[model samples]
Target: MLSKEEIQRYQRHFPLPDFGVEAQEKLKKSKVLIVGCGGLGNPVSSYLAASGVSCIGLIDSDVVSISNLQRQILYKEQEIGISKVRLTAQKLKELNHHVEIEEYNLNLNSKNALSIIDKFDLVIDCTDNFPTRYLINDACILQNKPFIYGSIYQYEGQVAVFNVNKSANYRDLYPTPPNPESVPDCEIGGVLGTLPGIIGSIQANEAIKVICGIGQPLIEKLFIFDSQSMETRVIKIKNTNARDTITGLIDYEEFCHPNKNKMVKEITVKELHEMIENKEDFQLIDVREPHEVEIATLDGELIPLGDIPQNEDKIAKNKKVVVHCRSGARSGQAIQYLQGKLGLENLYNLKGGILAWADEIDPSMEKY
Candidate 1:
C-alpha cells in the first residue's frame, strides 16, 4: 500500500512490462540488510531507498573521514568523525521519507552475524575486508537468505549474487582467504574515485532485479569490470560444494586468517609515548600512504603496506620495530607478514594505531 507520493516518486518504473503498482507493492514489502555503509553501500542503499524498499538496514563500525570523501559519495568533509551508518541513514531518509532506515553502529562479527542476518529477507555484502565477507556468506547460507556481493580493488571490481536458487557463492570463488599481507586494500593502494561509483551502480541494478524476480540475476555468475580498459567479463561460477561443509558459524577471523591465533605483541599508544619520553631505542614504521603521513604522522619511517616486501631491509635488525597505520588493521598485517613470511621476530604492532595516539596521548593530533 504505497502512498500517492510514493506512486509519483516511482512513476518511472511503472512503464516496465510487469513492474507497475504490483512490483512497487512488492518492493514496499521487501526488507534488505546492507552490511557496509561505505563506497558500494552508498549507491546500493540510495537506489534501494528511492525504489522504496520497506526496511533498509545499514550496519557499519567505521567513522567518516576526509579520505573517504573520495569514493564514498554520501558523506561530506563536515561529517568527519561521525558514524557512517548514522550518516547514511539520515541521508537515505531525506531521499525517500516513506522508506525506513535501520542503522546499527556496530561491526558484524561471528557472535552477532547469524542472529542479525536471520531477520532480513535479503542481504547485500558491501564490506571491504575478507573476514567479514566470509562471515556474511556463511551466515546467509545458514539462514537461507540470498545476498548480493560486491567488492572493489583499485580499478577492477567483482559482483555476484550468492545463496539464491542454491547457486554458487563466495566460497566457490575464493576457497580460502589469502594472506593479509598479500592483499592490499583501498587505504594502502588508493581507488579511483569513480571506480566504486561504476561497480556500486551495477550492484544496485542486480539487487533490484533479484528483488522483483523480473530479470535474470547474477546467479552462478560473477561480473568483472575494469574501468581503465573498459572491459567487462562474466564468468560462470562453479560451486566447490564448500557450502556443504559449513555446519555453523565458526571464528571468522580465525577462519579467514589462520595466523589469528599466533602470538603477536602490541604496544599501546601511551606506552609508545612513554618510550618517546624516555628516548627508547626502537624503530617506528608507518605502514600508511604518503598522503596519510601528510595528514597526520608520528616520528616514524614511511613504508606503505604494499611496499613492505621490497623495503624489508629498511626495518632495523638490531632495534625493536613498531608498525602503525590509520587503524591497527594494516599495521597488524605488517607484523604478521614480518613474522610469518620474512621470519622477523623483533616486531610489535601499535595497539590501535594513530587513532589511539590521537585520543589518548595527543588529543591535538588529527584522527582519520
Candidate 2:
C-alpha cells in the first residue's frame, strides 16, 4: 500500500532478506509510546521515526535544562527552559513527515498511565526513576502491550524487552523497589554522553524486531553494556508469580517511597537567609558531591550523602542542622536517612537547595 514516493524513500530497506517491503510496511503500521523525553527518549524516538514507525506518543512534563545537554542530544542550548515533549515532537516531525507525533506535555502517573498507554501498540520505558518505571510496567501489562526498557547509570546501561507474549515483566526482575537513597539518578550520578545513544538504539532495534516479527527480540533477557570497558552481557530473566499481584494500579510514589508518611521538615531559603542575617547558632551541611561544591557552595561543612553514615558525629546534635544539595532531593534523602537511622531530631532540609538560594538570596551566585 506504499505510494511510489514512499517506496523510493525506503528503497534501502526493501533489499534485506527478511526485512523488506513487508517489514517496512509493518513499521508503517506500528504505534509506539515513549515515556520520558530525556536522554534515552532522544535516540529511541529518533531512530523509530526514521525507520517509519506510524505514530509516536511522547509523555514528559520536564523542561529542557542546562544539565540535560550532556546526554539529551535532541535539545539545543537555545531550547533550554522549553517543554521537552513539544520540542521533541517538532524535531521528529522534521525528521519524518510520514510519521505522526503525539505530544503529552505532562508527567505520567497512575491516574493517566493506563488511559494513555492503552492507545499505543507498545510502550518504551526511558524513565530515570523507579516509581514511573513501575507505573509503566503495570499499565502496559494491564493493557496487554509489550514494553521496551532502557536505563543508563554512569558508564553502564541496560536494555530489556518486557511483557511480550505475557512473558517476564519488570517486577519479575525486581520484585520490589530499592531504597530511594541508595540509587542516584543521572543528575547525582553522572552518565557518559554516548551511553544513552548505544543503549537506546538497542531498545529501538528490539521494538522494530518485535513489531516486524522478524529476528529474535530480547524477550525475558536483559542486555547490559559498559561503555567504559566496551563490554556486553545478557542475563536471562525467569518469569515469576509477581504478575498475579498486579490486578490494578495503586499509588506508585507511596509504593516506592515507603517512608512517605514520615514527612521531613523543610526551611525556605528566605528563612535560612534571615537566620544567617540574625547570626543564629545553627549547623549547615552540604550533601552534594565534592565536584558540585567546586561549582557553587553555601560554605557549609562538606558531608556528601554517601559519607553521612561514617560522619554522623560531625552533625551537631544540640544545634539545628540544615542539609542541602543542588536541589532538595538528595538533601531530603540525607535527612531521611539521618532521622530514620540515626534518630536525629534536629535535622532540616533546605527547600529547593542551592538553586533556590542562588535565585532568592544571592543573585550573583552561579547555578548548575
The most accurate candidate by lDDT is 2
lDDT of 2 by residue, 1-368 (tens): 78788898889888887999899989999999999899999999999999999999999998887888988999999898799999999999999999999899999988888889988999999999999999999998888899999999999999999998899999999999998878878877789998999998999999999999989998999999999899999999999957788999999999998785466888999999999999999999999999889889999999998899999889899999999999899889888888988888898899999989988999788777
Candidate 1: C-alpha RMSD to true structure equals 1.8
Give TM-scores for every candidate, taking all chains together and pairing residue i with residue i.
Answer: 0.95, 0.94
Residues 1-368 of candidate 1: C-alpha lDDT, one tens digit per residue: 87888888999999989678888888899899999999999999998998889999999998998778989999998899999999999999999888888888999988988888877889998989998999899998888889899989989999999988677878999888897767878876668899888878888888888888878889999999998899999999998777897788888788777765475788899899899999999999999888888889996999998789899888888889899998888898878877877788789899889988998988899876
lDDT score for residue 357 of model 2: 96
Candidate 1's clash total is 0
After superposition on all CA atoms, what RMSD does each candidate show versus the true structure? 1.8, 2.0
Q: Quick one: best TM-score, which candidate?
A: 1
Error of 2 at 315 (Å): 0.8
lDDT of 1 at 153: 91
